[model samples]
Target: MTEIPMGPELLSPGQSCLATVEQLLDFDFDIPAFQRPYDWSDKQVSELIDDLSDAQRKEVHLFLGLVVVCTQSNGRFAIVDGQQRLTTLMLAIGALGGTGKILRPKGGGVSSLWISPRHADIGFAKALVSTSSETEQTLSQRRLKQAFSKLSDQKALNLATLLGAQLIVYVAPSLAGATGLFERINLRGKDVSQFDLVKNKLIEWAAVEKDSIVRGEIEDFITARYDTLYRRLDPSSKEEPFDSDKLLRVHWILFTQKQFKSSDKVLTEVDSAIDETYSSKKSIARWIESYLDSLVRVAETWVAVERPYEATPPSWAPQLKHALLDFARLGRDGELQPLMVAAIIRWQADATDLVRFCEITSFRSALAKKNSNHGRSYKWRVARQLYQGTWSDALKQPISLAADAVHQLFWANTPYWSQGEAREFGEDLTLEQVGAEVFPDNALDSTRFYKDYRHLIHYFFWKYGVYLQHSKEWADFTRIDISPFQDSVWFGNEERFKGWDIEHIYPQTPADRDTREGRAHLKVMTQWVDHLGNLTVLPVPDNRGMQNLPFIEKLAWLREQKKVPFNELLATPDYRGNLLNKPHWGINNCKRRITEIRTAAAKLWGFDAVRELGVGPYDNRLESYQEDIEEEGGDVPDNSAETVAA
Candidate 1:
C-alpha cells in the first residue's frame, strides 16, 4: 500500500468534475467486520440533505473533491477506496434523470471514458436514479440532469438515492497490502470503544437468523425482566437500546467462571467475574437469558420480602451489577433456593408487611464486609432489633447493620436475644426503638407496623411452626382457635339424617363462584365453621353431600349415607370423646386445640404461656414482649438469642 498527498480540492460547479461514476464503481472501500450496522433512519437522511442545501446557499465550501485510489485488475481501474461517496453520487445522478431532463453526453469523448454498465456500482446507482424524482422535479431538474449527463450513458444507475451528501475521500491500496491501512483509517477520529464494539457486534450477529420471528423472540426474551442484571448505567445519554455490556458481564460470571457453584465462590468471584465479562457481546444474549432466569429463582429465597425493588437501587448501576453477580453465585452454590422457599412461605402466611422484611434484610446484607462469614449472623440481629424497637429508629440505622443481620440469619442461625439477654451474651450491637412515637389511628400506621414486624413473625414461624403451647393459658382464656386441621366437615345422627362438608372455612375458591347471596352465605358459614365455637372432624364420605343442610336432617342423612347405625357410630371413642369430654358441643374442641398449640409455640420461643406479656389484645403482642424485656432491665435483642441453649 502507498500513501499519496491529496490536496484540499473542491467540487466546483463548472470545473472539470474529474470524479466520474467509473472510478467510484470500480473502487472497493473496506468497512471493518465489527462496525455497527447501518442505523440511519429516513429522517436523519433528510436532515443531511437539508444541511447540504443550507451550506450550498451560504456558498460555504461544504462539498469536498473525491479521493480515488486505483487498484490494478486486468487493465481496468477498480476503486480500492471511497465507495460510499461514489455510490451516493450515482444516486444523485439518478435523481436528476427522474425530473424528465434527458441526460446526454457531457464533454465530448468523456462519456466513453466512464465505467461500463456491468460495474458493481451500476446496480446501486440505477436504484437511486429511479427514486430521486421525489425530491423536487420542477426547480432542480435542469441542474440535476446536467450532473447526471456528466457520467457515461453506458453506466448503470443505483436503485436508492443516498441522502447524505458528505464527501468520502477514498484511499485505494493493493489488495495484498491494505489490511493495516484499512484498520488505521477506520480507527481515525472514531470514538467507538473496544467494549462497545464487541457488545454491538455480538448483538448484531445474534439478530441475523434467517427467520425474523426467531430473532425477535430471542431478543424479547433476553430483554424482558432483567433490569437488575443488565440495566443501563446512564440512560440519559445512551445510544444503544439496552445494557448489553452489563448483561454480557453477568453471563460470563455465571457460565464462564462457574460462580454459581458455591456460596463461597459466589462471594469471592462475583465482582471480578463481572468485570471480566463486561466487554464482549459475542455470546452475551443467550448467556444473559440463562444466567438471569437462574439468578431470579435463587434470589427468591435469599432476598427478604421487599427486596425486588429495594435491595439494589434501580439507578445505582454499579451496585446492581454486583448484586446480579451475587445472585448468580448464590444460584450456583444451591444456597439460594431454600432461602427463596422460606420467603415464599412467609409471603403465603401473611403478605401484610413483606416489603419491610425484604428491605431490612437487604440492608443487613449490603452493610457487611465483603466475604464476611458473620454477615448472615449480623442480618438476623438487625431484623430482631427492628422487631423489638420503633420503626423510625430502625430505618435510621446504617444499611450495613441490616445487611449483617441478613447474613447472620440465613447462614449462621444466629439468635436475636432480648436486650437483657444481649447484654449477658456480650456481643457488639446497636439497639433502637422502631415506629412512630405518636401512633396514628389511620390504616397507614397499621400497615407500617405490619410491614415492620412481619419479618420477625416469619422468623418465629420458621423456627417454631404454628405451635404456640407456651401461651395456653392466655389462648384458652381468650377462646382462640389454632387447630392443625385446616378444614372441617359436620355430620349428624338424629331423627332426620344429613351431613355438611365444612370445606376450607376460608373458601379456597373465592373467585370461582360469584353471587352476592352465595358470597354472603359462604361468609357467614365460614365464620361459624372456622371460629373456635364451631369445628368438627367427621368421616370424609359422610360429609360429601351435606350442602347447607340443617342439624336433624343432616344427622339422619349422615346415618343413611354412611351406612352405619347412628347410636353405635355416636358411641365410638371419637364421637363420645367429643360430646362428653368437651361439653360446649365441639366449640371447646377447636379452642382447646388452638390454645394447646399456641402455648407450645410460646414455650418454644421462650415466653411464659400463662402471662399476658403486658401486650394489648390487638397489638402485635410481640412488640409488647419486647417492651416486657425492656421493663425487666434488658438492653435489646441481638444475634446471640438465635441459637437454642444446649
Candidate 2:
C-alpha cells in the first residue's frame, strides 16, 4: 500500500489517457455503502452554486480538495473519493452555457469555459450530470452517448474542460490493499452496507458471461419487496447504520436456502440450528444457485401470461418468497408432505379469508394417531427426512402433502385430558375430540400452547367479537350493588367517604402557616396521599362537597349515613387488628378495603386474584372502563355513576 502524490498542474482538455472503464467502475466512489443513493435534484445543485457564488463575491475562499487514485494503466485514474465535488463542478460548468441559468457565469462564452465539447471525460462522465430537462436521464451507454453528442453540438464543452483542469491529488495502491485501506478509512465514517457487498458480488460474478438480466431482476426485487419488510420490522432503526457483511448474510439466508424453519419458534433456540445448517459460504452459494433457478422458472411462467413482458407480475411475490422459505424449513425437518400442504394453502388462499384453514389442517393431522409418542417421533422423523430428502418426490402433490403432514402432527402428540385418570388411561380420540376437549391436561398445556399460538388466539377472539356484536349473546352490562351493606357501599362510592382527591387529601395550604412553609408541608403530604391505593373513583358531586374534611368528620358522616355497620364491622377482630390498628388508621383501613375489592374484581375476570390484588392490574379499573367504552358506543363519562361505583 503506497500513495504517490500527483503535482499541482491540471490535465489539459481533450488529452487521451490509458483509462479502462472498469478501473473507474470497480468501486462506488461517491455514495458510501450504507448511504442512500445520490438524490440531489437539479434545483438543489443550482441553489448550491448560487450560495457558493454569493460566498465568493463576499471574498470568502471556499477550499475544495480533490482526491483521485491513479490506476495501473498510466495516465488513468479511479476516483477513490470526492466524486460528489467533481460531479457538481461538471453540472455547474454545463449550466454556464445558458445565460439565464443560476449556475452560469456573469459573462458567458470564453469566461464560462464554453469551449469544444470533444473532451475525453465526456463518455465516462455524463451519467453523474443532470440538466433542467423533463426527460428522465438514466445511467446507460445509450444515454451517455446522447448526452455527449448534445454537449458537443451545442458547443457547451467548457464544462468538461473546466473539470479536467481542476487540481487532483492522486494515491495509487494495489486493488487487494485498496480494499483494506477503504475499510479502515470508512470504519468511523459513512460506511458500506452488507446489501451493497452482495449486490456487487452478484454483478461481478455475472459479468463474466454478461448474465446481468437475472442479477438486475433480483436487485429490483429486493429494492421493491424485501426492503419494505426490513423497514416494517424495525421502523425506528431503519436508517441506523448497518454493516455490509451482516446484511449480505441475512439476504443469503432468505434468498439462497430453505434451511431455516418457521415454527413460530423464537430465534433464541433456532439460531444454533441455523448456524449448524446454513452458516458456511459454500452452503450458501449452493443454496443461492438452487433458489435462483427456482425464481427463474417462476419468472418464465410470469412472462408467458397475458401480454408477457408488458404485463406486470402478480402481487403475490412477497408472500411466495416467505412461504418458500417456510416450506424449505419444513422439508429440512422431514415433515415434507405437511409442509407441502401448508405451502399450497399459503399460495392459493388469502390469509384473512381462510383464517383457520392452516391451523385446522395442522391440528387434524396431529390427531390421526393415538400413540403418546407420535408427535415427538414424527418431529424426529421429519428432521431426518429433511437431511435425507426422502419426501422430496411428494412435494408436488399439495393436498396429499398437507394432509399427511397434519396427520403426523396430530398422531405424534398425546391428547390432553381434564383428569389424571383420563390423561393416563384415556382411549385414542378423533380430530373432533382433540379440537373440542378442554380436559385438565389441556388446561395445563394451554399455558405453553397459548405462548405459541397467542397471535391466532387474539385474532380469533377479536374477529369473533366483531361477528357476535349483532348476536343475542352480546348483552350490555349495567352496574348493580350486590353487597349486604348497601348504604355503606353507596357511601364508599361517594366523595364523603372514598372520593378523596390526592390534592385535597394532603392540602398544601396550612391552616396557620406562612405560604412557603405551608407549601413544603403540602409537598410531603401530597407524596404520601398521591398513591393509587389512596385514590378512589367516586361521585363528583359528593367529592366536591367533602374536600379536605378531617378523617374523624368523614367517619362520623359515614356512620350517620349508615354506610357501614360501622360499630360492628369496624370492631370485628379481622378488621380492627389487620386494618384499623395502624398509626394512620383511616388511611390503612382504606388501603386494606381497596385491596379486598381489587382481589374480588380480578377473580371475577378469571385472572390471578392474588397477583393482581395490590395497586396493580386488579386495582387499575381503566381497562374495565375501556371495556365498557368498547361494548357501548361512546366514551365512559368522567363522572358517571357506574364509574363511581367501580
Q: What are the per-residue Cα lDDT tens digits for candidate 2 across 510-596?
A: 342345644454454443353322333223454455555443444343334322122213333343336442222344554554343
Give the C-alpha lDDT of model 2.
Answer: 0.31
lDDT of 1 by residue, 525-557 (tens): 443343421322234464555644433344454
True-vs-predicted CA distance for residue 284, candidate 2, Å: 14
Tell me the spans in candidate 1 whose CA falls farther than 4 Å from its real position: 1-34, 41-47, 58-166, 169-190, 196-240, 251-429, 432-646
Per-model clash counts, in order, read 89, 28
In candidate 2, which residue ranges exceed 4 Å CA deviation?
Answer: 1-188, 204-251, 254-472, 475-646
* Each prediction's whole-model lDDT (CA): 0.31, 0.31
Model 2, residue 153: C-alpha shift (Å): 35
Q: Against the true structure, what is every candidate's RMSD?
A: 22.6, 20.7
**C-alpha lDDT (0 to 100) for residue 633 of candidate 2:** 18
lDDT of 1 at 631: 16
